[model samples]
Target: MILPALLGLGTGLSLIVAIGAQNAFVLRQGIRRQHVLPVVLICGLTDALLEVLGVAGIGLVVERAPTLIEAIRWGGVLFLLWYAWGAVRRAMRPEALAAAQGSEASLKRTVLACLALTYLNPHVYLDTMVLMGSIGNAQGDPGRWWFALGGALASLGWFALLGYGARGLTRFFATPRSWQILEWCVAAIMVVIAARLAFGGIEV
Candidate 1:
């Protein structure tokens, strides 16, 4: 019971702590202090929902749908590369980056990007649906629900932390150079993750 939940919590955190595309996007939005609430809410809720469905045994269905996975894979790769290009441009043009600091992106655009990052990434489905689902189910009976609860809690907590906690770096990102470096780092992460997804298959 409690043991399954504890295991779920640990596993959930371990998988999410990595600096993937979604995490990178969250960090940037956090630091920029724009659309933070919606961004975090979308991320937190989506993760929780996915974990719930996964625990309910949707993972098996997902496992059988390689075509859906392939579609998501290509969509994610294109989106990531396109996003990486935006980051690269920001990095290269420090003046624009600095000027855009005080600017806020529209709520709709932010929500769309958040949703895309959450769903389009094939690895996310693999991790939450397949891997987490299988692990939760192995706990058996009511323990699986407990496991899902733990994982959902972890997901919500981590997103809240990442999206809100990023403000602490405000002082550092005050300069254009700092912003450039940050954008470049974000671009690198997007490209790397996109490359892995494009070439590494579900093993990623």
Candidate 2:
């Protein structure tokens, strides 16, 4: 059980630590110190819910449906490429970082955007539903639940740290260079994931 749990924790963090739209949004909100708590809760809870669903056998269903998987695969590839393009464009803009610091979106709007980012992204399904689920189920019966629990805990821990700890780096991200670097990292991660999905298969 301990081994499975630890495996889950490591795997969960590995997937979540990748710089994606959801993480970028969370980090931005964290830096701004606006609606951080709610945003973090929503992300953590949603991830936990998805992880549970995956571990409960949805992963198997996804495996059996090659057509559905193919559809999702292509869709994810397209969305990720588009997202990467946006990141690259933002990285090239001198004012992009400064502008984000000044904007104060309403909580309602922010929440809506947060939800959209979580659900609309195809990588979320691939990571949480397909990848993580299959991995967790591999742990064996009762141990798989322990793995899921560990993964859920990892999700909670990561978002809590990212959302609350972002303020500490508020000064660092103030520089346009920092923003450029961050956006470039996001672009790279998105492109790599997209490429892997398109050519390397969905095991990652």
Taking the tens digit of each residue's C-alpha lDDT, what string does model 1 give over 1-204? 899999889999988989899899999999989988888888777777888888999988998999999999999999999999999998999888878998888999989999998889998888888889999999999999999889988888998899999999989999999999999998999999899888887662
Q: What is the TM-score of each candidate against the true structure?
A: 0.97, 0.76
By TM-score, the best candidate is 1
Q: Evaluate all candidate structures by whole-model CA lDDT and list the values in order.
A: 0.89, 0.83
Best by lDDT: 1
What's model 2's TM-score? 0.76
Model 1: number of clashes? 0
Worst 10 residues of 2 by lDDT: 116-125
Report the lDDT tens digits of candidate 2 across residue range 1-204.
899999889999999987777888798789878999989998999888888999998866766777776777787678678878977998999686689667777999889867866775556777887888999988989998989999999999999999999999888887888889887887887788778878887543
Clashes of each: 0, 0
Query: lDDT of model 1 at residue 168?
Result: 97
